[model samples]
Target chain A: EAGVAQSPRYKIIEKRQSVAFWCNPISGHATLYWYQQILGQGPKLLIQFQNNGVVDDSQLPKDRFSAERLKGVDSTLKIQPAKLEDSAVYLCASSLGASISGANVLTFGAGSRLTVL
Target chain B: TQLLEQSPQFLSIQEGENLTVYCNSSSVFSSLQWYRQEPGEGPVLLVTVVTGGEVKKLKRLTFQFGDARKDSSLHITAAQPGDTGLYLCAGDPAGNKLTFGGGTRVLVKP
Candidate 1:
């Protein structure tokens, strides 16, 4: 029972630069999510994918951020022309399914900390 | 959009003390979840309550769901330093998404 796996534990980039983060969810999981957690705040959902399709991404900044789950197993989130405000931890989570029942519990990765200068 | 509000943005107490955190929402939910997150790490699920008025306990931690399924609470008894972390509450107002509340940061000193 391995946990959700994320890569590049830490990243630093200058303003107006670009950065990308990758995630590989647990095997057999059908739902995957990307969240941004700023200091002293709760993690905010950036996008959600159910299999290979997107379920929700209304909160995501379309102008600078984009994410995709190719083949429904691995995901990548990218930010271009990064801003200082984008400095935060990017967390990846996965669940068996998107059900209203208590069975839909999420497991998260260690997260990638991005420091935008 | 549904919103969950958490109380006591931050708390600090001595070890062995008891503390409680609250999560409230105006909209009813089908299920609610509580998670604990440490520095530089992602959140980990602690408990999930689905039924109205349901109560679940995990070791020294107790979680209760409101009778109306609109609120939840987490109580820690005889807290230890290891309990220090940010506590988050999320609600499944819709089957498709889980809305999270601003977390409550707790620090237990030994």
Candidate 2:
């Protein structure tokens, strides 16, 4: 039972530069999520994918952030023209299902820490 | 726009001490989950309470869901160095997405 995998562990980019984070969820998981955790703060949901389709992304900043789960097994989150405020850890999580009866437990990744100068 | 508020943003205690953290929200939830995260790793689920007034225990840690289903609490007994970490609470209102609290950072000195 391997945990959710994410990379590259750390990243640094100048303001206005673009950066991308990748994630590979656990085997057989049907729901994937991307969360942003600023230092000293709780992780905030950026986007959620159920299989190959998006289930929720209302909190995502459409102007600068985007994410996709093409085949439903893996996902990528990208930020363009990054701002200093964007500096935070990007965490990836997966679950077996999203239904109330399905346990709804989330297994998270180590996360990718990004520094925007 | 549901929000979960966690109390005592930080806690520092010596080994053998006891402490408790609370998570509250005005919105009702179908279930709530507790997670503990280490410095460089992601959070791992400690427990989930689905029924109101439900109480679950994990070793020295105890979790309880409020009868109104809008609050939860975590209590640790005889804390140890191994218990130091960030404790977070998340609520599943609709079972589609989870709303998380800011988290409680616990430091247990040996």
Candidate 3:
């Protein structure tokens, strides 16, 4: 089966601009996640969705970063008025399920590299 | 928020050498996972340790979860050039929320 898929492998934009990234999770996966990773840091969760419903998004930068998984199979992330600090990689991941008993493994996409100049 | 700290931010070794990376957390987690990430790609799961004091092996890699469920370690035997990359450890709080460590970069030169 194909792994998670992401678009616009790379993006370059000036500060205060906007950018959007798309992701398609593995078939049948019910959980989706969006993460932000700095050059040398671990990925930080921005949002998570379970079958088209949001589960968690407390870490998201609500002011500029927004993500939605309309049908639970595909998702999109948008960053408006991108700040210089927003230059990083946006990663999409999916899992079959998640809960106390269902600690499923996650499959991640190649990610969208954003460069805010 | 749960936070994980990885030791030896970077490691450089020769082929056939052994190396160990540590991930520590102050909070308990229902499960823990280890991932290897190469340049220009997302991380790939190496192993997941669920039970406390559990040990799982994958090829030349060995993973151990602490008895306290707040720490884990990854050991690579006979490291090779192909093993050079970033190693990340993530802790799941049973809510499906994952907290990742700072990550350790390992470079094995042949």
User: Which candidate comes out best when scored by DockQ?
Assistant: 2
Q: Please, what are the lDDT tens digits per residue for candidate 1 over residues B25-45?
A: 999988899999998789999
For model 3, residues A1-117, the per-residue Cα lDDT tens digits are 999999999999999999999999999999999999999999999999999999999999999989888866889999998999999999999988764645668899999999999
Query: What are the Cα lDDT values of the candidates?
Result: 0.93, 0.93, 0.92
- Model 2, residue B65: what's the lDDT? 94
Candidate 1 structure, TM-score to reference: 0.96
TM-score of each: 0.96, 0.97, 0.96
Model 2 regions more than 4 Å off: A98-103
Alpha carbon lDDT at A75, candidate 1? 99
B-chain TM-score, candidate 1: 0.97
Candidate 1 chain B weakest lDDT stretch, 10 residues? B91-100
> In candidate 2, what are the lDDT values of residues B7-80, reduced to their tens digit?
88999999999999999999998899999999989999999888899999999999999999999999999999
